[model samples]
Every structure is written in structure tokens, then in C-alpha cells.
Target: MQNKLYLDQRSNAFIILNLLMLWGWWMLYQLYALPVHYAKPYFALDKIPLYLEWSHLWFTTWLFVLLCICYLCTCLLLPHLQVAQVSVRWTLILSILGAGILNVMIYPVGAVDLFYYLTQIKLFAYYGENPYLTTFWPTYAHDELTPLSSFLSWPLVYGPAWLGLASLPIKFVGFDDLLTMLLAYKLFSLYCLLGCAWLIFKLLGGGAPGWYGAYVFAANPLVLFEAVANAHNDILLTLILLVALLGLRHRHILALPAFALAALVKVFILPLALGFAVALWRTRWPFRRIVGGSLCSLLIVFLLVAPFWGDGSIIERMQAAVEQQQTLRTAAPISLANEYAQTSGASAQQLEQLRIVFTASYGCLVLLALFFVRPLEHAMASIMLLLFLLVSSLFPWYLIPVFALLALHPRRLELGYMVVASLTGLLYYPLGVVAWQTEGLTLFQIQLVGATLLALPIVVFLVALLFQRRVELDQ
Candidate 1:
């Protein structure tokens, strides 16, 4: 009886832990706004502070829990249920329609990037200038520039394809009406969501398990909440990357076009795209195939960027972009440097020195890791590089690509990604302001805690894999 009690306790604990993660994701979506559990006599969620200010935060948290439960129920019922007897393609169509309408309802509350996005678009559309350079439009239209623009430019600097897309909603919906504009933006992202879902469903029919990819991809706390709700443009790039991978999977040379589109949308992703290209070359495909692909991609990138570069030589535009990208201190890639400097108490020059070394080292390591694994499992390895970038950051939205892939490919080791990403993302019920402050942690303390939290389990998984050799023979 005692042993039975202990077993039940352990099971319940894990369930609770999963519930916490789901709730956290929901709260992130709600920003704690809708008290999803408000009417319940007995709530399954941890109650947020009753103060109106804390309301949105906790409410969203509860909603995340509810969504997870629904998804969990979906899973539990799968074995006994004949729901999947429906055709794969048809199931996807239903999901897109269901998920799309639900996302639209919560769309307003989902967006945190809206203000910055709107401001930047206005600067570009109305001012006839590169918005990345202008920082922010002057409040007076002829007055002093916004100090805020200097930092916000990082997310604003997408390629012309994105710039054109951003302007579309405002064109039809009137930027003066913030609500309509926001909805239009949501609709644009919605298209990407539906496309990604449809692709995942197609893959599952081909062989991949729906449990690993579909459940997590469509309903994962991270992807649904952050990508759909928050309206992050990263989803657009992620879908393109997924489409590229899917094309590659089918041995369609069309992967190059998809890869090119992704690269043109976001320059930072070119290295990742290039890595995938190299992996593709090792296959039976002729060498000239990718050479043609590369030229075409380069042409597209140049044509779109030509307006910005035509005023000066290619060298000049490249230099300007370098200057422009330096302006933001928040978010991944940059924030890693920002935090490193803040914690080190280093001068600007020292920080710059560290930045160069880290970038070079990171790039070399990434290439080495890519080459090492790329040859082993070309598709899986290339996707792993993207995962490396997604988790190595603090922002909630970076997981868009990982989650989308999870839906389509579904790996078991995602348990590692899930544990880490949950700490900062999907299961991300961020520490309360008081809980965070009261901890009074230094940078070193922060690193220690975070590393232990994320790494310990991953190390365990690695160890268990080694013992699996013995377990296999015993079986």
C-alpha cells in the first residue's frame, strides 16, 4: 500500500508539473487578462494575485493550463477514439478553420509587438525612408527623434518582402484604426499558421507520428500562444524554413526557392540556409543543381535589397546595415551580448572585443557541429542547428520554428528542448516580479541555476542512451 501511494504521488507530481507548464503558457497569452477560472467553484490553476494589475498575468496562465488539458484529453482519447479515421488532409483543414477562428478572437490580447511594428511601418510608409535608419518617427513629425527607436530597430529590420506584407493590412484597413490594423496583421500571420499546419498533417500521413509533432506543433503552449497570439513575424520565416525542409524531404529541387525566400526575409538565417544547402549537395543530386539554386536565391536577395543599396555601392549598404543592426539591446543574439556585458561590468570596447570573439567562436562551433551531424542525418541535423538558436535565447517567439518542426517531424529528444524551452517559453510561467526580485541573484547565480535546471536532465538523457545498448541486448 505504501509503495502504491508513492507511485501515485510520483505520477500526480509529473501531471501537476505538466499542468504548471501549460498554465504558464496560457498566462503568457492572456497577459493574465481573462480570468478563465473565475467562475469555477474549485479551480485547477494556481490563483494569481487578485489585484487588477496582476489579473491578466494569472488569467493567461490559467488559460494555458486549460488548453493543455484539452490537448492532453485529446491525447488520452486518441487510442480509443476513431477521430483520426478521418483523412489526414481533411483533419488539417478542420484544424486550420478551428484554430484560425479561435486565434482571431484572442488576437488583440495576443500582440505585444504591435506598437513597435505599427510605429516602424508608419515611418517607412509615410516618411519615404528606410525605417531602420530613422529609428522612430518624430512625435511632432518635424521634431526630435525618439530615443526608443534606437533600441527597437532590431525587430524592425526585416527584408522588403516582409516590408511589403506589413504595409498590406494598413493599406486595406486604415492604419488610423489600430484595431482593424492589428486584426489584419493577425490575418497575415494566420495564413502562415495554416500553411505550417497543413504541411505537418501531410508529413504525418507519410509516416511521422502525430503524437510527437501534431499535438505539440498545433497546440504547444509556445507556438500557439507566442506565434499566433503575439503576432511575431518570426512565424513567417519559420514557415518558409519548414516549407524548404519539406521540399527537400520530397527530393524536390524546389527546396532552393523556399530556402531563398526564407533568407531574403531575414538575413540572419542565411547561414542556416547555407548549412542546409551544403548538406543537400552531398546527396545524389547533381552539384550544378544547388549552384543554380544559390544564384537564384542571391539574385532575389539582391533585387529586393537593391533599392537600399543602389544609392551606394554594395559595400556602403552592407556597412550601413551593420551600423543599423547594432542599435537594439533587447532579445536574443544581441541580449546575450548585452547581458554578458552588464554582468561583466565591461567597458564598451571590452564588450565589443568579446562580441567579436564570441561571434567567431559561435560561428566556428556551429559550422563544426553542423558538419559533424550534417553528414550523419542531413535533415535532422540541419533542424538541430535551428533548435540550438531557438533555445539559446530569452524571447518567447524564437521557439516558433522549433514548434513548427515539432508538429511535422516529432522527435523524442524534444523532451530536452521541452524542458529548457519550458523554463523560458511554452511552460514559461515567468517568475513573478516579487519571486524574481526576492531571489536577489547575481549573474553567476543566474547562470548556475539556469544551467542546473536545463542541463541536468539533458545529461541524464545522454547517460540513459548509453545504457540503452545493454538494454537492447537483454531484450
Candidate 2:
């Protein structure tokens, strides 16, 4: 009886800690509003003065301490959650709802991609213009939202399915009011996030009675910030991908259309879809059935994209995507390489050539995995890991698919996810208050820091793999 009471008290504390973290995120994001406003119009304005006038270095130090504490608290709570099963389920649901509501009002962090999404929707739904043909910047250049023009210079490179999916709620809200349209998109993202949580719970329910995996995912600080606060469409992408996997698990071949739809949401899901298709084939399913599904998926993809396809514009859009991919630098190996080359005084032509080589090499690695990795979960994890390592640009939100895949097999990957995802939040430092005053760290320096942070996990994983191999050899 005494032990039971003690366990209940500990579980209560765990629930409170999670709720506090959600509230903390809301407060932290509010702090961004002042800084972001001051930096807008391309930093042509004065920096906002803080109460204590904190130095960038000191502020970053404190921020790191806070995040580390959050990570440690989360790690401590997971085991307790396993014991206090029923309580944890209610906590997960409450935490997600609380975070989603709070994030709806928070300032976007790291990137303003949300605004670009809105602009594309407005163009397609309201202006009756094909977003593929009209870049948001040129169309809205003289409009009231022109201050955002600087970031929307790039044309729509998102897939046709994304445009279609994004257009629905946008059309419902009507485009004359930007804030309402913004809220509509955010609400849509929130719906996807809630769906992901429920789906994860259903997927993992057979083995465990607890909401351990779902709690880790839904209540993850990075996931909350990216999925809810930033209003990224990646949440929607992950939702459809989960649908495909769930359908495949039930042996429903119609899952192929869902997978195709997922791919059309973003081409990034292609490798994972292919991996799923291969897994389906290995089950002794008939070749004709697989071929038929593939044909149907292809047809669906073609039909969705056909309306958006313009005279010679498809080639132009493809080129734009290639250019965008080549120039991007974020928390990935290629970003580090690209920055190293640039800081070494490499010319534009040399940087472009290097990007091509990096991309080609990354392609080969993914192809090897698609052919060799058999299990759908393992293959999806492998593909996402490759992306995390090889992509030229990665944001915290980019980790959603990875988090979803690893939630299925978190026994090994959860710790790595927590560490890396927590550190990835530091990417927003450049947008913070002190950063504007001090001009922040250079992009290359930030990449170096990220490389060092992520490399620790890479080394640890490789060492573990090598140790496991040695044990097998000894056996």
C-alpha cells in the first residue's frame, strides 16, 4: 500500500513536469514575437532591447541548460509512465491539446515557411492562378503582406497534392484575411498532429498497455515546436504516410494509392514508399497484384500533377527544385561540407559541382538500402537516417517522419532521438533577441556546432554496431 502511494505521487509529478514544459514552450515562443518583429523587413530596424540586456553567448548557455533539463526530466519520466499506464494516457492527450492551443498563438521559429504555404494557397484558390506558374513574391509584391516578400522569392516546388491539400481549408477561410487563412492552416496541422498521436497509440497498443511511445512522440518538445508552433506541412505529410503503413499492415493493396498520395505530398516519401512496396512483394504476393498497384499509384500521381503541369513549366519547376536543393545548408553532413568549402574560399562554380557530387553519392546510398533492407519499419528508419545525414537542409520539423518510424522501434532509437531533437532546437538561436544585437554566429559556425552535436550519436551508433558484429563473430 505504501509503495502504491509512492508510485502515484511520482506519476503525478511526471504529469506536472510535462504540462509545465508545454507552458514553458508557450512562454518562450512569446518572447520571439518582439525579436522577430524587430528583425523583419530584412533587419533594417533596431534590435529589441531585453530587460537584462543579455549577451548572445550567455543567453545560449542558459537556453542549453533549460533544454538539457527538459531532456533529463523526460528520460526520467518514461519508465514511470510505463508503470502508471492509465494516468499516462490521459496525460498524453491533455499535453497534446494544451500544446496545440498554446502554439496557435506563438511566433513561428527558425523559418517562415508557413507564410509561403499560405501564399501558394492564396494564389491557387483565390487568385485563380496556378501556383506553379506564379511565385508568391511577384504576385504579392505590392500587397500588404509584401514585407514577407523577401522570403517567398522561391517558386512553388511542393508537389501538386500538397497544393491541393493546402487549398481546401484555405478556400474555406477565404484569402482576403491573411491571419484567418493562417489560422486555418494551423488548425489543419493541429488536426494532423492529433491524428498522428492516435495512430501511434493504435500502432503500438498490441505490445504495451502504456502510452510510452505516444507520449514520447506527442509530448516531445521538438515535435511540438515544429508540428504545432511552426505550422509546417510535414505533419500532414507524416499523417498520410502513416495511413499508407497502417493500410499495408492490414494487407490492403489499396494502401498503394495512399502511398502515392503521400509521395505527391512531398517527393521525400518516395524512398519509404518504395521500401513499403518491396516489403509487400516479399510476402509472396502475386507479381501482377504488385504491378497493378504500382500502375494505379503511378496513374494517381500523374492525374494529380497533370492539372498543375504547364507548357515547359514542369521542366522549369524541376530546375528550380534542383537549384534550391543544391544551395541549402542546415544541420546535415552535406551542409558542413558545403560550408567548409565556402569558408575555404571556394567559388560559386566549385560549390555547385560539389553539391552535385554530394547529391549523387546520397542517391546511391538510398538505392542500396531500398534493395537490401527488408522490413518496412527498418527501411523507413534507414531512409530517414540517411536523409538526416545527407540532406543539404534539415530543420527540427524534418525529423517528424523519423520520430514516427522510430516510435515503432524506440527501444533502440528513442535516446538518440531525444538528444538530437533537443539540440536541433538551437537552430532558432539566430532568430533570437540577443542574436540580432550581436549579429549571431555565422551560418557556417552554426553548421559546425550542429555537426559536432550530431556526430556524437553517429559515432556511438557505429561503435554499437561494431560491438554487436564482434559478439556475433565470437559466437
Candidate 3:
């Protein structure tokens, strides 16, 4: 009886901890987050400033660091605080409630990428302009609401499916009010993320591990901040990718269109589809059926994306992607390499050569993973990790899919996920943009930070690998 009572007490404590964490997150957002244009037009909470002063920005940055530490600590605490089997459903329920509450808060706390999304949706919804062909820069002069157009003035970098899905808010809510549009977009993102969590729970068979995984993702500070507060479309992209992977497991025909749609959202997942397709083809399934299913999937994808196609716009889109990649050397290893060369007084030609080598090498690594990695899940995780490590720019939210993948098998990648997610938040330093613009942080310093953030997990992973190999050898 005492032992049962002890377990009950622990379960109650766990429930309390979950609610406390949710409330803590709410407080942090209310007190520390910088104001963005998304909420500036709507409800103004007097406690929160309309814009961040220098002191507030600095405080917010430090508070963000503290919150990340708290987040990781909570994750570590959860395993020991498991609730009763009956209470398992409460985990997902509270997570949904927390997400909804945060979404309704209407403040763009951690990121400004939502503005870029807003601009993209507005371009298509209001002006009837092709986002792929027309740059937002031309429209910026006339639309005062579309702030930060200068930062993302390039042509459409996202895929057609993402463009279509993300633009739904503007269609229904209309772009006349920033607050309404922001709310609609965030609510949609909330729905997508919940869908992802649900699928994860279902895929994991609703066991203890599955429930824990669902809660881990559903309540993760990064997920709540990125998926709810900042409202990144990567959440939607990851959802579709997960659907495709699940379909592949079940041998469902939707796998093809799902994969195609995922590619249309991000385009990075397309290669993984090729890799998994090869695996599927090698299965005992009939060759003709496989071929027919593949053709039908492709046909549906083409039909869905056909409306966005224009005469000779593919080349334009490709050029835009290349140019954008070339300009962005923010958080990836290639960026570090280029910064190293520049600091060493290398010429433009030398930097260009370095870019070519790194880019090609990155491509080769991805292709190898696509071809060699077995089991579609492992292949997807490998490719996503490669992208996270190699991409020229980085954001904490970019790791959402990675964390989702890691939820399946948490033993190996858990430490790496925690490290990357927490450290990447350091990129949210106050005045980072100003520092970069004014060269306050020299090229070498920025490179050093980026390198550290990328290298830590990699070093840990390598060390773990070597240790495992040594254990096997000894055995």
C-alpha cells in the first residue's frame, strides 16, 4: 500500500511539473520576448513592450538561455516522473492546451521568419503575382505591413506545396489585418504540429515510449516556440514527410504523393524519396505494380503543382535557389570554411573555389546516404542530420524534423538533439544582426561560434562511435 501510494504521489508531482513548465514558458514569453509586427497591430499587453529596447533585448537573450537550460532539465526529469497508465492521455491533452494557449498569445517571440512567410502568402493572395517570378522587393515600397522585405527579397525559395498550404491563411482571413492574419497562420501551424504529434504517437504504438515521445515533442520548448510562437512552415513540411514515411511502412500508395508533397514543401526530402523508392523496389512486391503506383504518385504531384508552373519559370526558380544558397553562409560548415579563407586574406576566386569544393562534397555525402542507408527511417534521419550540419544557414526550428525522427529511437541521438537545440538558441543573441552588419563580431569570431555549435555534437557522436567500436573489438 505504501509503495502504491508513493507511485501515486510521484505521478501527481509529474502532473504538477508539466503544468508548471507550461506556465513557466508562458511567463517567459510574456516577460522577455521582443515584439514583432505580427502582434503589434492587435492586442497590446502593457507589460510587454511594443518594441524591444536595448536592455530588454539583452535581457530577453539571457532569459532565453536560461529557458533552454530549463527545457533540457525538464526533459531529463520526465522519465523519472512517469504518470499512471490512465494519465498517459493527459500528457497529450495538456500539450495541446499549452500549444493553443501559446498560439493565442499573438506575439512573435523567437523568430522573424514568419514575416517572410507572410510576405510570400500576401504576394500570391493579394496581388496575383507569382512568388517564384516576382521578388517582394518590388512590392515592399507600396506595402508598409510587409516589414523586413529587404532581408528576403529573393524569389520564392520554398516549394509549391508549401506555397499553397501556407497561403491558405491569407485566402481565408485576408491580409487586411496583421493581427488576424498572424492568428490564422499560427492556428494553422498549431494544427499541423498537433497532427505530427498524433502521428508520432500512433506510429509508436501508443505504448509508454510512444506517449513519452509524443509529450517530449509536443511540449518541447523548441517545438512550442517555433511551431506555435514563431509559426515556421517547416512544421508543415515535416508533417508531410512523416506521413510519407509512415505510408512507406504500410505500403500505402499515398507514399509517392506524400513524398512529392514533402519535396514540394522543402525540396530537401526529394532525394530521400529516391533512396527509399529503391528500397521499396527491391522488396518482394511485383515490379509492374510498383511501377504503376510510382507513375500515379508522380502524376498526382504534377497535377497539384501544375497550377503554379509558368513558361520557363523552372530555370528562374533554380537560379534563385542557387543565388540564395550562395549568399547564405550563416551557420553551416561551408560558411565557416569561407569565413576562414576570408580571414586568411584569400581572394574572391579562392572563396569561390572553396564553396565549390564544400558544396560538391556535401552533395556527395547526401547521395551516399540516400543510396547506402537501410530502412527508410534511418535514411531519412541521416539525410536530415546532414542537412542540419551542412546547410549554410541555421535556425533552431530547422531541427524540428530531426527531433521528430530522434523520437523514434532516442538512445543514440538524444544528447546530440539536446545540445544542438540549446546551443542553436544562442544564435538568438541580442543585436546579432547589428553586430554582423557593423563587423562588431569579426568574421573569425562568428566562424568560431558557428564551428563550436556545429562541432560539439559531431565530436560527441564520433567519440561515442569510437567507444562502441572499441567495446565490440574487446568483446
As a whole number from 0 to 100, the lDDT of residue 366 in candidate 2 is 72
Per residue, candidate 3 scores C-alpha lDDT tens digits across 255-287 of 777887887787766656656666586665566
Cα miss at 298, model 1 (Å)?
2.4
* Backbone clash count, each prediction separately: 12, 0, 0
Ranking by lDDT: 2, 3, 1
Q: What does the lDDT read for residue 389 in candidate 1?
A: 32
lDDT (10s digit) by residue, model 2, range 188-283: 888888888777767766434226666666666667667876778888888888887777777667678888898787777776766775778766
lDDT of 1 by residue, 356-410 (tens): 7756665664565455531222333334333333323334565566556544533
Name the regions of candidate 2 deviating beyond 4 angstroms.
29-52, 55-68, 71-76, 82-86, 206-210, 342-364, 367-375, 427-443, 453-475
- Give me the overall lDDT of model 3: 0.65
* Candidate 1 Cα outliers beyond 4 Å, as residue runs: 1-56, 69-83, 86-99, 107-111, 125-128, 139-155, 204-212, 313-344, 347-350, 372-393, 419-475
Better-scoring candidate (lDDT), 2 or 3: 2
Which pairs of residues collide in candidate 2?
A: none
TM-scores for all candidates: the values are 0.70, 0.85, 0.85
